[model samples]
Target: MVNLMRYRAEAVYREVSDAGPGSGVTGREADERYSPIDILHDIGASVVFMGDVAEQLLGDSPVWDRVGVVRYPTRRSFIEMQQREDFREKHLHKEAGMAETIVAGCLPIDPPAGHLGEVAWDDVEYPPSDGDGPLMVIHVLRFAEGDAEADMAAYQTAAFAVASAHGARISGWFGVEGTIIGDGRRWDQVRFNLFPSRAAFMSVLADPSRLEAQRAHREVSIADTYTLLVRPAVDSLAASIQSA
Candidate 1:
């Protein structure tokens, strides 16, 4: 079996908007705006073999605008894709389209210990798991807006509370500056969180019961939110959820 690390990477890019902070686009519109990034995904398919895509869900990196997830057959495969000539060429366009982006590499630790949730859709059946499971290492990116420090703090506080209450684990959180995306804009902050499974993430983001928590987040969030789910080369590590 391949000792692969699963990843959930998030990228956020801006659409032509006159709105300022707190203006969020609906999930459907976000999908339309993110449609352009699909080309670069072909590269992941080329080397990674089996992979999935999570459109705009959350911004974790400093300058992230668009996010994607890749599951390579091996670490070597992951590395190889990054170095591929075609991928390198395609990346140029990806860089041009986005203002900023965030990416993370993660490992899913069973019995998830610490983590937080940023956003989750309203009605969706997330991947199954018992809630307490492995830590899925994740990389995140966010395009810098007005004040990253203040924005990140608010995002972390609200999101963490939501996730923690539901039993998730957060291993670490860090910030990355600048990116190879080649856009004139640079990233502001990058965050990290490890969850037992996608279900945990969904619970935090979707729970209608948490209306107060969601309302509390009104000030610190962007209208446009995106999320991507990625996995490692190894298949067995996939989290298994019980049938409802």
Candidate 2:
């Protein structure tokens, strides 16, 4: 069996109403109980990306508050962490804070080369017209029950060119393995992409050439998929944590 690294991407929707600071116990309080960074670090897990969900592009899915991707050194490391008592204790906070969530595990396969370092949000360029903030798109996909390999190849060849033309860069890509936690949702692949703005992204989607290319590969290869637009929450989170 081929040993592959594991990654989990979570879509988190936090409780809407905030409980008072003095509230003995509440979902908000649970969320504030502890940060999982230290534990994740001790267990050799790295956060690939973490941010606030900015927009919903597909169905009328409930709004998500945050989206994050975590990388584990090994699949065993992931399993071991979950089995640890301390880890379980900390997880209560996550559950308390979350109104709804989806977590999916994936195997890193042919992730874009050279984009694997700690991301520098400052270096990310944004269109002058888009005053909202830097935007990122997360794609969750499942392949059809056919020649998945060939379908992927055909889709990628056409998609890459269109992506580049629209000034979108792929930050991360992985093949879905199975669920490690949360709802038992399955996927075949997941991708993170950065775009200048929503308009820029729409341009890519509306491109005649790109649409034409999709018919030849993407349409046939993908059985189901969903995408989310998000804003980087790392910088703000880091600032708050440091100040605290």
Candidate 3:
């Protein structure tokens, strides 16, 4: 799941749960206390990545505080976990800490190798080191009707030329399965882009090739999108989610 969180300024403990501090605790801290490692292990799931939002590079969605991706062995395991008393008990911490969240089921895939000529989208065979220090740009997308792939292919062909100039690459590209939690907005895909650094990402702001592609192809293909820049805390998604 791709989790975009907006934390409450102060944690609000529900009446039924008395597990966390009632005062002077930030929502993020309270959420940290909500970890259910054992419950996850029982279902053969794991958190593949977690990061704080560095900035909102594109789109008009509400600013997010943190982003995380969790993997489940199966969707049924997730539902079953929710029904467990222990899981429900721990969920209170997340409830108290979060003011809003967008939880989208994300399935990782190799980026369309055809469009990206030399950009490294091959995490399945060779995953990059976190030490490469790329900024993770999360793209949440909703495609428009008919022949979206052709337009996207054209867009990627142009956009990636500019992207390659900045030493950028694809970390992971996901097809959004469904929304687990959100404001009922439908999404098509979520793409993870990795730029060498914040400066490198910013430098491509006015690249003519990218702008032309955006104008000619990308803009017309997607009805909605959000491009987020995140600073990763931990990331094993590239290696783990390919099989997941």
Candidate 4:
């Protein structure tokens, strides 16, 4: 699941059945208290990555504070965990602190192959970030009304080509199955690009190939999108997934 959270300035415990963060507390601090690790353990789920937003690269969506990617053993396990009394008690903090949240159940969807012949994704060497460290650029996208899929595929193919050249990888490319938490707005996909450094990501923007792809496919395909850059405390979700 990919979580996009927008926290309130002050936590508000409204009609919550359980005790949680009270007044005068900032939402971020309050939410910090909402850990239900025991429930997660029981369900065999784990947090893959969690981080604070470093910057917004694109989008008209309201600014969000935090991002999370969680892996679950099964969807049923997730639902059962949510219903557990212990988890519900702790959930009050999230309920009180969150102004809005969007939790998208995701499944990996690799970008189309064959474009980068003889250069497989696995063969690409990903080096540790230099300077301030690696950053993940996340994109939440909603496709346009007509012929969007074809256009997006072409765009992703072209975009991936440019991204790979800049030492970036598609860390998580997901198709949103459903929205567990949302405010009516819907999304089609969520893509993540892990870059070695801020400097490298900046270079991706200046690449002429990226511009050509945007004009040729991206602009026509995506109707709405949010592109966020974040420095995750857990740098590599792929490592965790692979080990699991």
Candidate 5:
């Protein structure tokens, strides 16, 4: 079945620059050597979203710099690519550039239509003052023990209500299966939310109604969570990557 792979990478570029070095390969050169997107395109995998972290809303010291999601035609395609000798060779560059990373294979689940109907891009309210572009928040969650399904449902009901009221848009949601690569941290679900701006997101946090609604569900249902705010890189680089 079609599946999505989510990757969070913490790159260490101390030894690497945007430009390549002369003789010996540097970290930047190693990153250049990794061109899995081309191979992924050939294997019918499509980029979903790729962006860099702009802020950390709720989490320990931030370690990840970039996060990306790619959809593969089938789980087998991903496995087959990994089994290829050439693919293994290309992975060396990835290892060189990345200090830490996590790759999770997830299955998409279609929840009932959320209370907050889809908000059009134009309809989203911008900050009254200077601010960055649209903000995307990544939520990595682990549900409490016993009947994870029930916990998920409870959390979603309250979260959707609060999110809808706050004008937050759900960009992506998935149930994480397990780690496919990198650090073996386990997560139950992954969600992406788009806010009009940083101001809007902050407003959401301060909304008393939202807080009251979310308190009970969040506390009882979640065991652990991580939230990262990211600026969607909509430049040519992101476009090219998506098209690849």
Candidate 6:
């Protein structure tokens, strides 16, 4: 809960600035956008907001390009929020403005511990902790041929703990229910972790603890793992939004 609050405040502070593509939205304009989101803070507000606003502003309707996530304090709170008129009307409209969106519910994993080494979290003029690509550890996991529910629950339990301990700042995680594009298969679990640096990431991979955990997890958790070395670049037109 403490971590959630800290991150929320951080997001609000960081978000309420020239973070978006500069279409001339001054400070005052940004404040207006954040007003509604801020009021919902204490009502179990741990969410991950992501998308390519640039693409959005261009009027492209590419699917999965924009999203707003709201995390409730409990399942009950989530249910209540979904039922609330304000939540339904305002939230849905805000989302509809986007080109594409998907909403999901999930519980957090445990602390990630096994890692390679520590990187200077402050070295970069701008840290890619949340925006994109510090190092994305993508896992291709699948449940049993029939017992999908039981398999997913077990994977989440172990993944959360291990990820948190490894100093992985989880942006968010989700489970896919329907068929994925290109394949008729369904992905049971998806997790995203942003490491401080390449060395920091390697540390976890080489850790004895991580190795042991990997061995245990391989038994029932993962079908395959693909590492995408992504480095999200600040678009050429977005040069004015420089980091302080």
Best model number under lDDT: 3
* Each prediction's RMSD to truth: 13.3, 7.9, 4.2, 3.4, 5.5, 12.6
- Expressed as tens digits, the lDDT of each residue in 18-86 for candidate 3 is 644356678898789888888999889988889999788777767889999888988889888999999
lDDT of 4 at 51: 85
Pick out the ten consecutive residues of candidate 2 with the lowest summed lDDT: 1-10
After superposition, candidate 3 runs with Cα above 4 Å error: 16-19, 114-132
* Model 6 ranges off by over 4 Å: 1-39, 48-63, 67-69, 92-95, 98-100, 111-113, 121-187, 196-244
> Which of the numbered candidates is closest to the native, going by highest TM-score?
4
Better of 2 and 4 by lDDT: 4
Point out the worst 10-residue segment of candidate 6 by lDDT.
Answer: 1-10
lDDT score of residue 137 within candidate 2: 77
- Local accuracy by lDDT, each model: 0.40, 0.61, 0.79, 0.79, 0.64, 0.40
Worst 10 residues of 5 by lDDT: 1-10
Prediction 1 global C-alpha lDDT: 0.40
**TM-score of every model?**
0.39, 0.71, 0.87, 0.87, 0.76, 0.41
Which regions of candidate 1 deviate over 4 angstroms? Answer: 1-51, 58-152, 208-226, 234-244
**Candidate 2: pairs in clash:** none
Evaluated at residue 184, the lDDT of candidate 1 is: 46
Write model 6 residue lDDT over 121-226, tens digit each, in one string.
Answer: 4653334455434554433345445444455455445544544454555543455444312224444554545565455556656666556655554445444332
Put down candidate 2 lDDT per residue, 91-164, tens digits, no spaces. Answer: 75676566656677766555543322233434434352547445677777777887876876766666666666
**How far is 165's C-alpha from truth in model 6 (Å)?**
16
Candidate 5 achieves a global lDDT of 0.64
Error of 6 at 72 (Å): 1.7
Which parts of model 2 are misplaced by more than 4 Å?
1-21, 24-29, 32-34, 59-63, 111-133, 235-244
